[model samples]
Target: MSDGTLRLLLPRFLRRFPADLAAIVLLVLATGVATLAPVISETPLRVVLGLVFALFAPGYAFIAALFPERGPAFDGASASATADEDERSGSNLVERDESADAHTGLTERADPRRAGSIDGIERVALSFGLSIAITPLIGLVLNFTPFGIRLVPIVLSIGGFTLLASAVAALRRQALPVEERFEVPYRAWVGAARAELFEPETRLDAVLNVVLVVSLLLAVSSVGYAVMVPKSGESFSEFYLLTENESGALVADDYPQNFTVGQSQPLTIGIGNHEHEQAEYSVVAELQRVSIRNNSTTVRERQELDRFSRTVPANESANWTHDVTPSMTGERLRLVYLLYRGSPPAEPTIENAYRETHLWVNVSS
Candidate 1:
């Protein structure tokens, strides 16, 4: 686009101007990504991104709401000429409102300058506080629903709300005269900061700039180090179990409280390889009486119930069906699934166990 065309599109020197339709398309895509990326990626990542969106999205939406019309901020020198030209053209809706207000005895509201300019550090602080306030209120509302502040629901709700606000912002901006809309002043800020950051007026200012840069670099490096470095010898493997109902739905709660001496209860067992390498696993399912006292557990009278083996690839998972039928009945008995590396150990202890999980099961006649 020509510089003149671009200048007219974005009235403010701070806002960046893009082709009209393209800007809209980009906003839509960004909103979609912010909302739906969690579905494609991991749940943890989705939650993190959702939190980020919650923090910033509300402020943006609030800013847009503040200036639904967003009339350009006018300077004294050029405004009178533009005003007279608008008067001559008979095209200023805002001007007509002033005339109507005079007849109706209602005060006319002028459009916000620089199209609802939120350009200063103080405005930023206010917006951030407002966003923090808005986010929890929304979460409070969602807490009442079945979604219960989950990643997908929160992301979609906030993302959709932000999208609506953005559309309204875009519509208002588009409705404005070419010389009255805001631009995304990226290039302007880049040039200004680069040129001005080091060129301080005094020695103290120069020292302050250097200190700020150093502090920023230190913060960034700390975060980088945290992300890139592993915790000292930290390694883990994930193992889990799930029980299924007759309808093949996973049963997360209300497990059967009573089982007959010879009746079978089926469950699915999964092992995840997160130890950073492939490993063959020998698993044992045992029935035992477990006693816990003073933050310690003691297993006694343990009976071997079942045995199985599997090879799992690194950073992957393997799951299978296992059936348990009580050979003996007892009160507050335990069903333990013990995992060991390679060959089965002579016995399974928590120390030798790569991973283990158990259920507090009861058997009755």
Candidate 2:
């Protein structure tokens, strides 16, 4: 029923250290930042910041907990008096000079169960474990939520670790006696760590750290590689005829008059790369034409030249147009494209490249 018992039952933060209540504030800030990340970033920078903040949250909590100030119970005169009484009791033993030394030794030796609490280390380890477990779960849940696409679990993990570190720092600052709180223990821990570095027993921890670091680096680099490299063998090419009037039409007027019948006329050319790869040159086209000739014996011809030159990259397409006029004098005429492939000057083979029109054109004498 005493205040001391009541204090022990309540959370440390509720009992004291209200002014150093920065951890909660930081948690709120990080949450807000993460929520607004999609709005703020055209790139994924907001997501990156959100992840960083998530990692920082626990650390922030730890640090806030570590702020230097003795709690009210520990700072009071009653605690000091208790220490003085204990010292006086020790002094009394020397004055008696009986087998008191032996008796004191017996009592001290008997009280082997008086080891100090490992509560601080336990709390830190518990916090670390909880942070690691919960953050990933939260992140996974967030991913299923509407905004989850932007908020990944890795970011959440970062935030969780940050919060954990902050909490440890804060607990260290607040729990231990002034002289023994951080400095001495930290130095001792450091010395032990240095010694352990050379110890064979510590190799497992080192190996685990290395594995984690490597995995993280690999994941990050994989994302970067995906963003930078083009996909292979993916391209598109399209060609459409643009008439002189801007209407989508292909007519004899669309091409030079000197373009001879039977000789290829360039039509619209288009190239596209759908794969994440580059093509030195590729072409695709859409063609339209009307052929006219007065004499039935006149030769009617439509050919596409192989001279056009261009390049296409993965996942993209281009378009170009060419016109053809028939030299044949024929009452009825058909329009089509003679497709060619390969480098120019040398004849390019046209296997199935021709697109013949179903409609017949009437030639006027």
* C-alpha lDDT score of every prediction, in listed order: 0.67, 0.47
Clashes of 2: 66
Q: Candidate 2 versus the native: TM-score?
A: 0.29
**Cα-based lDDT at residue 207, candidate 1:** 87
Q: Model 1, 201-285: lDDT tens per residue?
A: 7888888888889999999788657545635464678878887777876655556556678888887888888877788998999
Q: lDDT score, residue 158, model 1?
A: 64
Candidate 2 lDDT over residue span 1-365, tens digit each:
99689778988775653323354446545565655565554334444545435443453355335433332332233345544776886656556767567765754443312133233344346556555565666667777765563534445545555555555665666665543332213444577667654453677877866676699999989876754452445333433333344565445344333333455544443444443555555332222234346742333354342244556654556565554444443444544333323332232223444221122443333
In model 1, the clashing pairs are 14-185, 15-183, 15-184, 15-185, 16-183, 16-184, 16-185, 73-113, 73-114
Summing lDDT over every window of 10 consecutive residues in candidate 1, give the lowest-scoring window.
68-77
List per-candidate RMSD values in Å: 9.3, 16.6
